[model samples]
Target: MRKSEYRISELLDRLARLNQSELWTNDLNPAQVAALKYLMAANRFSRAPSHVADYLGATRGTVSQSLKTLAKKGLIEQIRSAEDKRSVRYDVTKTGHSVVAIRTNLDEALAQLDQNESANIALLLSNVLHSTLAARGGRSFGICKSCKHHDKSANRPYCRLLIVELAEEETSLICHEHDSAA
Candidate 1:
């Protein structure tokens, strides 16, 4: 097998070292990871629970389990959707935002590092991480909804994600890149 391809089982073994117990000691669990991962990808906006589950590579039961813990901690709250009466979307609380926002500094650093990092190292890291995510059909979901270029027009907003017109009320997620309204 190519060096880029580590057998699937071996991949998790290497990644497991990066996992920490502190999160669970404080009441977090794998389920919360799924929900949080979903919210992280969803931006600050809310999304249907089913979408969260699908993206997390988890079952509805698992997403529901984690959402309960997150809701109890006030890290996430559910809101009814105008588009679908039976559908509910979850929004991360400010505290939850803080938890995810901590990575902003890291992103900024990476943005800076990209200026000089050799192509070889970047490629290697990307390959390793991408391999793992691709195995599960997961994606980092990086884009400009988190960027300063995004704007809110009235209740709706326009975004770079698609050329079509949009609204703040329409956006399901906003990343760190979006600037607060001036």
Candidate 2:
């Protein structure tokens, strides 16, 4: 790899490690924390265990175990899908929301950056992530508003792919079926 590429990869690795270290709190491991955070940011359609596994790039078994631990801690609860009896969805509890509200060192550091700098960094990182996921044939799991299926020209935002109307707030959350407009 080029020197710049190597440096970028190394920096990302170190930052990820630091972030993971800080996630170990409230008697929860990094995996559980990640699951909770993802659920909190995910829309209703992406709350299933399968979607969680896809988002984490982890095995269903691994995701299942983490979910079980979260449930045991009262951080998440399972809801039976009314449309599909066999389908189960996970929702973050109030406790989970509180846990996610706790700011980490990374958040504090990022908060120090100016808006322009932060936005530029976010765009660059998002591009990198999209390229990586494309290469690996992984799901984008991007925000609903950024997906090609999102139709905002109407009175209400709708998902053409899902053939359903979306709440204004749901338009900002992530979705497993997201197809990037880019």
Candidate 1, poorest ten consecutive residues by summed lDDT:
17-26
User: What lDDT tens digits, residue by residue, belong to model 1 across residues 67-94?
Assistant: 8788888888888878778878888788
Scored by CA lDDT, what does every candidate get?
0.60, 0.94
Pairs in clash, predicted candidate 2? none
Cα lDDT for residue 68, candidate 1: 77
Candidate 2: tens digits of C-alpha lDDT, residues 18-95: 999999999999999999999999999999999999889899999999999999999999999888899999999999
Model 2, C-alpha of 72: deviation from truth (Å): 1.3
Candidate 1 whole-model C-alpha lDDT, 0 to 1: 0.60
Q: What is the lDDT of residue 113 in candidate 2?
A: 100
Q: For model 1, state the Cα shift of residue 135 in Å.
A: 7.7
